[model samples]
Target: MITDDLIVKMTEFNAGDPKRIQHFIKVYEFAHVIGAKEGLDENTLRILDIASVMHDIGIRPSEEKYGRCDGKLQEREGPAYAREMLAMFSDVTETEIDRVCFLIAHHHTYENVEGLDYRILLEADFLVNAMEDELKKDAIITFRDKVFRTKTGLHLINTMFGLCSI
Candidate 1:
């Protein structure tokens, strides 16, 4: 399966860096949970899974080129690396590749989201990032209001970050 292949390749691509490996793996896991709970069809789920694993594929290259891996750099350098890594698999269709690449390119852009897959990727990455980055309550609430739309994604953000007084 491409998911398995992606895991292996992502792991290899992030070798010797447990933090990077764990970040992608955690993002993939959250994306899997939210995608399934949100009832994404098989095709969308597959693309989400692939995109989650390969979302940060540009981090290394960005850091190498610009000495930092900010959102713009990742967005700029990610699609090409993602395309190359995805090309190693034969089952992934051109449409799938295009869609995943699109999601990766826009994952950091919160406004003008165009699809469920894109929204979920942002939610999933934010879910992991909230904890990884130790985001504060105000930022979490602001993002929850501005970015999150799906029921499942919003619920996860609220519960995970204690946005609501329960």
Candidate 2:
């Protein structure tokens, strides 16, 4: 039930700067592309995309409070905003909200990718991040087998970044 409107609102809320806003949008786009390739159900795909857009909601406050934006603050501050904003979407249940919030809460950590939905979003975010971080040199061999968890994600990353497939 989560709509594109909700995703936009959360992205705007979480992203204070143009770069941050753009980052979330890119992550969401990556998520959507992967969802199509992975054949995720509509509802599940909505949650994944919404979660991807809202993933860094805590970064703003994290920077303010700790003078740095990092995983601990995301785990600490992200879910609360996700819970509050997600309330507007009637189709989004508490359980779905909690799951999305949980992913946002733990996004920077790689320990929680056991689930396919989360794994897909995580890899999508990493694909975008690796590009943003200019980690292009190792886009293939170094992380060819490491960061990518899906065939679709690997394809997108390799193709878009101009890296030869592994």
Each candidate's number of clashing pairs is: 0, 0
TM-score of 1: 0.96
lDDT of 2 by residue, 26-97 (tens): 888888889878999977887788888888888887888889977787778988878888887787788889
How accurate locally, in lDDT, is each candidate? Answer: 0.90, 0.79
Per-residue accuracy of model 1 over 24-136 as CA lDDT, tens digit each: 99999999999999999999999999999999998999988999999988998999999998888988999999999998899899889988899999999999998898988
For model 1, what is the C-alpha lDDT against the true structure? 0.90
User: Pairs clashing in candidate 1?
Assistant: none
Q: Which stretches of candidate 2 lie over 4 Å from their true place?
A: 14-16, 139-141
